[model samples]
Target: MSRPQQVLASYRSLLRATRIAFDGDHRVFMAARQQVRQGYETGRTELTSEPEHYDEIDKRLEHASGVALLLRSNIVQGQLMHRKANEEPLSTGDHGIASQSDESVYKLRIHKHTELGDNDAVKGGKTSLAGTAKKIKWSNIDE
Candidate 1:
């Protein structure tokens, strides 16, 4: 529309973008707001005189809005990652939430011979690791 309106819209958009870019950091937003306002005031006369530059001004405002949107997306992604990291320790059986489905099947002999009777030499309980090893007299073999 009019040059004055266009200039005001751009100025306002710049302030809004600056506020978003800093997220909730008020100190930085205020500093950026002041600088943008001063810059807009100083350039007001020049913008009004150059009617042909309206298209270029619109493009620049559009670009600034896009950049702010991207910054907000980036901030959201970072927050998601932080939240995921915090949630991990509570899941995957780390914080005493062990998954019963993962019960180890390491007792192979017991599992394979679950039906064995008392007469069998295999035994009635789970096999120990040391029991799997047999000791032989190497001296007799050497003799």
Candidate 2:
């Protein structure tokens, strides 16, 4: 594909990633969109002006693609919980929006893009700080 096409694809990927990452958070979504646009707009001239800068342009494109992947896979939105877990469960309104009477807990929005890893490392129970507690010095005041 041509360089221009590649650049456009990168821009679209970033926008879509941000949408997925910040679905309900309008402020953050707009901010991220602005940043992506600004980054591309600022670099457009320098990327096309010099032939030697093709390498730089390629690097930027790769970086943008990586950012999109990271956002899509690692980022997650959270739902606000108003009441305690022990309390009654929240009621979904007619519009399907949960009321935010309080700001205590957040329920993570896990989707297919969210990366899930095995618990092998956690189950291993290996510890480098095993003897850390024994290193503390205790002095008696009676002395």
Candidate 3:
């Protein structure tokens, strides 16, 4: 089993690291400290001889450190650095009217649509609006 002194040292180290990284927030510092203490306390009665247990904790610490570093860098610049090239040109085509042809063209140049269309006027006769229209009276329905 790992020595009690080693366990206590690790618990304090974890708290210190977390507290420093999140010093600006009072709540975060206290929460991190409490969490570290609770974690060590939970395993206080159990043995710490397993290599995997310590390995998992080490990985968690490394991840937390990485996150802190990234946040610090972001706060300093006020913007995140993307992995891709800056201002990369995207593939785009010039705006133009579309046509149903299989061939591709920048512009479709048809002067007229068809021989007859909606603009040709009503074929039957002139339509009446106000003279033939009737006003509807609303009625209440019983529930």
Q: Measured by TM-score, how close is model 3 to the native structure?
A: 0.34
Pairs of residues at least 3 apart in sequence or in different chains that clash in candidate 1: none
* Candidate 3 local lDDT, 32-136, one digit each (tens): 677766766666544355775676555554554554444332221111123334443322223212332233323321111111123223454545222332232
Model 2 misplacement above 4 A: 84-103, 121-143
Clashes of 1: 0
lDDT of 1 by residue, 28-117 (tens): 768878887776665655555466877766765676566545443233201111233324332322111122223221111111111223
Decoy 2 TM-score against native: 0.70
The estimated TM-scores of all candidates read: 0.38, 0.70, 0.34
Q: Evaluate all candidate structures by whole-model CA lDDT and list the values in order.
A: 0.46, 0.72, 0.42
Q: C-alpha displacement of 67 in model 1, angstroms?
A: 5.2
Q: What is the C-alpha RMSD of each candidate to the true structure, in Å?
A: 27.8, 15.1, 28.4
Provide the lowest-lDDT 10-residue window in model 2: 134-143
Model 3 lDDT, residue 66, Cα = 52
User: lDDT at 89 for candidate 3?
Assistant: 33
* Residue 13 Cα positional deviation in candidate 1, in Å, after optimal superposition: 1.7
